[model samples]
Target chain A: MAILLDGKKTASELNETTRKRILKLKQCGIVPGLAVVIVGEDQASQRYVRNKHKLALKLGMNSVIKEVPASITEAQLLALITELNQDTTIQAILVQDPLPKHINEQRIMQSISSTKDVDGFTAVNVGQLYLNLTGNYPVACTPKGIMTLLEKYDIFLRGKKAVVIGRSAIVGKPMAALLVNAGASVSILHRYTTEIAEYTRDADLIISATGVLRLLGAEAVKPGAVIVDVGQNLDETGHLVGDVDFNAVKDKVAAITPVPGGVGPMTIATLMQQTVDLTEWGLANGK
Target chain B: MAILLDGKKTASELNETTRKRILKLKQCGIVPGLAVVIVGEDQASQRYVRNKHKLALKLGMNSVIKEVPASITEAQLLALITELNQDTTIQAILVQDPLPKHINEQRIMQSISSTKDVDGFTAVNVGQLYLNLTGNYPVACTPKGIMTLLEKYDIFLRGKKAVVIGRSAIVGKPMAALLVNAGASVSILHRYTTEIAEYTRDADLIISATGVLRLLGAEAVKPGAVIVDVGQNLDETGHLVGDVDFNAVKDKVAAITPVPGGVGPMTIATLMQQTVDLTEWGLANGK
Candidate 1:
């Protein structure tokens, strides 16, 4: 059997490191702060926001949740974002996904100040990552977290054949950028891909964020390929699963990140870690 | 022999459309303006700027050339850009590349306002393109022009396998993004790419931007593949050529863009077109 990537354990270690960084900031009378803006009472979004809030407080940092109605006008949302952009205490800002249909989501997302853009959804930050600019900038949490996990396992990325399945702004796009910057020959596949297996079977590393259950199995992937499943889907039995068929491909792959204990945990850990980083970067730049 | 992707003819047709757009703007008492900023007395840079300036004037639009010395500091350059940003008459701005070692090139490039970024090198514009976000925003000229050229040839992008060699900020990266956005599976190969042919041979469409001479010949490419060569290099005879071995592969490929008449002409034409686009967009948005 292949070795489990052990995201849960790695996330805990990362969170531990974040905690120490928070303590250092506290010593300097600087407290890192994160504000999550949720437009509606989405059950999933609510739960995710609550977890981030609780974790921030546990790590001894200030956290704020801005919960508004789904009927909030785009202009009203923009005003709220502008206020947060100028708020000195808020070092990191995230607007919860699945925003109301009435709101211009991209506009609202891009409105966040680049310094406090915790999720790195803004075009400026995304551009920086795409350009491989030489400077400190935030990246999409899930992908950046995956990079950390891969580094922990000593997976060589340079010149490696990698396949990223999906083209999402928050996950797949940024994931490919990170891999490409690492000197990996990265292919980005999406819904229009005629043969996913054609690329995946030759890849040394495969990242799937398609949210399609059982999207990949042993036959679809190369032997000894490292697999990262970013999907959070419900199987036929309603069990939370990833994009890949773990039981089928686990033995064939060299290493794999599991569904629940994989990318999910690392995302939150990286968010917290980045919150502290933004705080330190702000202090260093006298923001 | 393969059909040539005649960029010179296509560019002229595009220039005609741009001229009409300029006429429309002029009828509304608005002169679309472009400013090309050149630092130092680099002959090549000066010539390119002059071509842009001349094109803007030929299309009956206002064109300005800002020539500065090589000794100018980063602060001075930024200040100059700020001046152009506030200049209501200047609709599009381009800063010549290969800037002095002392100046931070990306910083100066990104400093241009997104609306006035004629070259579309600004991170915001790049981000928009990468995100595939809707609405009118400029893109890097060379790749955007290549898209136009491909469209003219009626090349199908959806579900196609595309190999974009190189990952430069202005050409390769944006070209890949455009191809991916159009639903093609894109693999970006760089110098670290192990076996370039492993992907190129399988690609239905190949866009090579790496400035390497005689990179691809008939043997390296697939039969009937649509090839777009963005490299403009010199052969042993000092004749201007492209990344592809045109003479060898021209008879084997379905279509190809000739070096001198290919991507080169379309780039300037696209810049002229986008200047008018930015101008009209500015007028509509009251910028």
Candidate 2:
């Protein structure tokens, strides 16, 4: 059976590190601050935001949640983002995903200054990350979290064959970049790939983020392979599941991340880390 | 036999388009300007600089050639780059490759502002290119040139399997990103790649930039595949050659690029086009 990648434990350790860093910065008269803007009451978004708020405060960082109703106009949202962008006290600004249908998410994202783009979703940061340039500000949180977990587990990426299932802008794309940085020969298999089995079966490491339950079976994984499941899919009973067929592939893999406790905690962990990093950066650079 | 991808004729046609654009911009009181800095008088570097100078003039852009001694210190070279970076009249900057061993290439490259980073060697540009984020900046010229050639031939890259047999920062890495942007599944093979022939033989498009002569034979390529050879290795007899055994693979491939007449010309063509593009962009946004 595969060794389960304990993201819950890893995330707790990361929080410990972040907590120390936050305390150190405060002694220097620096207060790490994160501004989160949520439009509309997405129950999931609210819960995620509250969790972040609680975690940020626990870590000794100031957390401010800006709640705008669903009736808010795109212009008003832009104004809020701009206000945060120019606010020196707020080191990082995160606009929650799935804005109202009338609000343009990309437009709102573009409005945030790159320096304060803690989410790392701005074009400048994304572009920098893609080019392997030096100013690769914070990368998108989930992919960064995935990389952090891989490092914590001592997973060897150099010269390994990595197959990333899915080509989403957030997870798969940045994941490939991080893998490539670690000297892995990476291949991205999207909906257009026909020979995914051929690629996945030979991979030393496989990252699945298709958000589809049981998208990969035991036959698609090699024995003793490292598998990272970033999928968050709903099963028939409305329970959350991952992309890998866990039970079928468990014995074949050397290590794997379980759905509920694996990558999930790391996502929030990365966000918190980035928020702390941004706050420190802002204090130093006066962003 | 593989049909040769004619980079020479294709590049001339592209220059014409660029020249027309430059002329239109000039009519509106805008002239595309390029500042090229050449360190040392290496034959290859000299030849490349000459070609760029000639092409810039042909495209109606102001071209400035700054030749520095090979023994110049890194600080001296950086001083020259800083001037060009801040010069409003200079829209694009190309620093000839193979700088002195004592100079750190990455530091020198970072000195070039992204706006004037026509070579696209900066980490930020590479990151953006990898992410497929189209910023208001010039892409790495060589890969841009190759993409233009592929499009000119009406080769649809969507859903195609591409094999890039090199992983150099300049050519192979950016080339793979370009192929991915066009919707192709790219497998990048390097020296460490085991069983590279298996992947190369199955690819719909094969691009070799390893500079090892005759690396790809007829048996190594799929019949009717499009082969692009970016290698420019010289034989012991001083003859320029590519990575593929042209004679052996010529009969099987649908299209291929000849060694000297292929990617070489396109590189300069793209450089010239970028020079003009930078000038136009500066005119419109230089304020």
Candidate 3:
């Protein structure tokens, strides 16, 4: 059996750490603040927003939820984000994904001031990450979560073979960059890739965020490979599953993360952590 | 026998194209200027300065060679570079490397302005290359040369496996970034890599720049691996050699570059092209 890479336990520890930091900052009359914007009240989006806001309050920070109508234009969305960007009280801004199709997602994403862009989707933030400049902006939550997990596990990335089985901007690209900067040899497989197995099968660590359930079987993974599955797909009975074929490949791997209890909790944990980070920076530096 | 990747033949074509561009700019009374700064009269530095000056003149651009004494402090070298950075007439600046032991190399390298950094050693240029930014800056010459070779042979980098057997700041790191940005799955191997063969043997393309003669043998490279030998080491008889065992691995590889005629000329060619680019951009945008 593979050793479970339990993210829930790790995330709890992180949340506790964040709570303590928030308490300390409060004594100095500083409150970490996060502003979350959601459009049209999509159920999934609402759930995420609720969890984030609830967690922020529990951690002793200020949280604001702004609900917008589905008819909101890109300009309006941009205006709201820009206002939050300049708001003295808000330390971090979160614009939840899945805005109405009429909205120009790209422009709206870019409109968020890079400093308050806790999501790390803006080109400016991407550029900073690309330059290995961690001076500004929070990195994407999931990738940052992965790095945190790696650091917690004492898994050194230097000179190790890392294969990321996706190329999405939010996760894969940033993840690969983080790995490369840490001195790992990174191989990213995307839609255009012909021989994905050739890269993945020999990797020291495999990170799959393709969101395709069971994309990696036993044959696709090398024995003793450390597998990190970022996928979250519903199984036939509506149970959450990951990109890895856990039944087939679990025993062969050295360490593997389970679906619901793995990367999911880490993502939310990083969000809270970055909110606090943005808050602290603002307090100290007054950004 | 493998086909040779001839840099002289390819660079000449590129230079011919650049020469035409220089003439177009000259018609408008705009002269492309390159300043070569040499601190300490090292024989190798003198040769490099002379070659660059000769090439600039041959391409109908203004070239100036500035020599400073060996005992020059880091601050003094930086002062000279700062002056060149502010000189609008000088389109590009090249500071010859391997400076005296007393000077801090990184500090001096970062002092050069990105716009005038024809050698592409400045932090901004490196940041652009690191981030794969949209704007143009002088890329390091060797990577540009390698790109020319790849384009010449119609070898596609997208979705291919590339193994770089070095990690130097000038060649290896930038080379890996270029490959990764172009969609190649790049793995940069260094002295600390435990399983170099496991990575190199599976690569579709392999680039070696360690400057250690015969560092890669038949066992290190698989059959049909396109090898770009950026290494240039002099044999006991003063003949130029490369990292690859050319005699032993030539028959096994699909293509390879000869040491002297392969990457050498391409560096100068790229320098000339960047000088012209700098000139054109300055004339058009007043950079």
Candidate 4:
């Protein structure tokens, strides 16, 4: 059987480090604060936000959720973001996805201050990531978390062949940038990519974020390949699953991350860690 | 046996369109203006700036060269950019690269206003390009010119396997992003990459921007593959050459671009077109 890259265990270790860092900041009279703005009542978004709030409080940080009605105008949303930008106590600001249809999502994202953009969805942060700019800047949580996992596992990426089976701005694109910046030859496959196996079969590392159940199988992956499944889907039996057919490919691969216990926990852990990072950066820069 | 994707002919066509647009803007009492800022007395930089000035005037646009001393401090250079940013008549601003070692290049790039960043090195513009933002932001001239070439030739990118060699921010990275955004399976190879032929041999379209002489030879390319050479190197015989071995690969490929007349001329043409675009955008937005 392949070695399991346990996300739950890794996330717990990281959360412990974050807790200590939060304590140090508290002793220095700086409480890390995160504000999550949600428009309308999205059950999934609500669950995600609640989990984040719970974790932030557990870590001794301040967390608040600003719930706005679906009827909020774009102007009102912009004003709210501007207010959050000026709020001295709020070190990190995240406007949850799936805002009301009328609100221009990109414009709302642009309104968030880049420094406090904990989600790292702003154009400035995205651009800096692509430019490989040095110094401190928040990165997209999912990809940043994946990098942490790769580092912890001591997977050297230099000159490796990495195939990313998605092209989303959130996960796939940023993940490819990170891998390429780390000296890996990166290929991005998307909906328009024909014969995806032709690329994946030769990959040293395969990352699937396509959200399709069992999209990656044993036949598509080379033996001894490291697999990271970023997909969360419902199987035919209503069980939570990932993009990879983990059971079928586990014995053939060198290492693999399980669906529920893999990348999911790392996302929340990264959010908490970035919240503290943003707060510390804000303190150092006197913002 | 292969077709020559003539850059000089295509660039001339684009230049004519840009000239007509400039005349239309001029009749509307708006003259497209570009300011090329250079530091020190580098012969290559001087020649490049001179060519740009000649092209701008030929297209009936206002162009100026602001030559600063090499000893200028970062603050002084930034102040000059600030002045240019506030100048109403200047619609596009370009800072020639290879500033003195003392000046931080990234800081200097960030100093230019995004609206007038004709070279598209600014963080906002680079970010917009990666995000595939719509509307009127300038793109890096070389990549934009390459895209124009692809479009003019009616080479559809959808579902194609494209390989881009080199990862410099100016050309390789942005070019890969553009191809990925256009629905091509894109791979980026750099100095760290091992056995580049392993990827290029299967590519439907190969774009080489590495400054190495004849990097993509007959052995590395497959039969009937389309090649675009973005490299400009001086051969041992004192003649300009590109990354591809043109003579060797000429009959083996479906189409190819030559060195001096391929990507080079398109750079200046795209810069002129962006100048007109920036002026029209400014008029529409009342900037």
Best by DockQ: 4
lDDT string, candidate 2, B115-209, tens digits: 78898877656656665665566777777888988888899888788888777677877887788878888887777776778778888998898
lDDT of 4 by residue, B1-287 (tens): 77877789999999999999998987888889999999999998999999999999999999989999999999999999999999998999999988999999999998899999998888888888887877678889999999999888888899999999998889999999999999999999999999799999999999999989978889998998999999989999999999999998998999898888998899999999999988888889977
Model 1 ranges with Cα > 4 A deviation: none
Candidate 3's displacement at residue A221, Å, is 2.2
For every candidate, what is the interface RMSD in angstroms?
A: 0.7, 2.6, 3.9, 0.7
Between candidates 1 and 4, name the one with more favorable DockQ: 4
Candidate 1 lDDT over residue span B1-287, tens digit each:
99999999999999999999899889989998888889999987888888888888999999999999999999999999999999999999999888999999999998899999987788888888998889999999999999999999999999999999998899989999999999999999999998998999888999998889988878888899999998878899999899999999988899999989999899999999999999989888977
Chain A TM-score, cand. 4: 0.97
Which lDDT tens digits does candidate 4 get at residues A1-287?
98888888899999999999999999999899999999999998999899899999999999989999999999999999999999988999999998888988989988899999997888889889998998899889999999898888888899999999999878988899999899999999999998899998999999999988888888999999999999999999999999999998999999888888889889889999999999988888886
Candidate number with greatest lDDT:
1
Please state the CAPRI-style docking class of candidate 2.
acceptable
In the order shown, the chain A TM-scores of the predictions are 0.98, 0.95, 0.96, 0.97
Candidate 3 Cα errors over 4 Å, as ranges: A35-49, A64-85, A93-138, A278-287, B36-46, B64-82, B98-114, B117-138, B282-286
**lDDT (CA) per prediction:** 0.93, 0.84, 0.84, 0.91
Candidate topping TM-score: 4
What DockQ would candidate 4 receive versus the native complex? 0.83
Worst 10 residues of 4 chain A by lDDT: A119-128
Docking class of 4: high
Q: What TM-score should be assigned to candidate 1?
A: 0.95
lDDT of 3 by residue, A123-238 (tens): 55664565565354678999999899878887878878889877676788789778877888777777667788888888889999988878889999988889999998888899
In candidate 4 chain B, where is summed lDDT lowest over 10 consecutive residues?
B127-136
What is the lDDT, from 0 to 100, of the residue B71 in candidate 1? 99
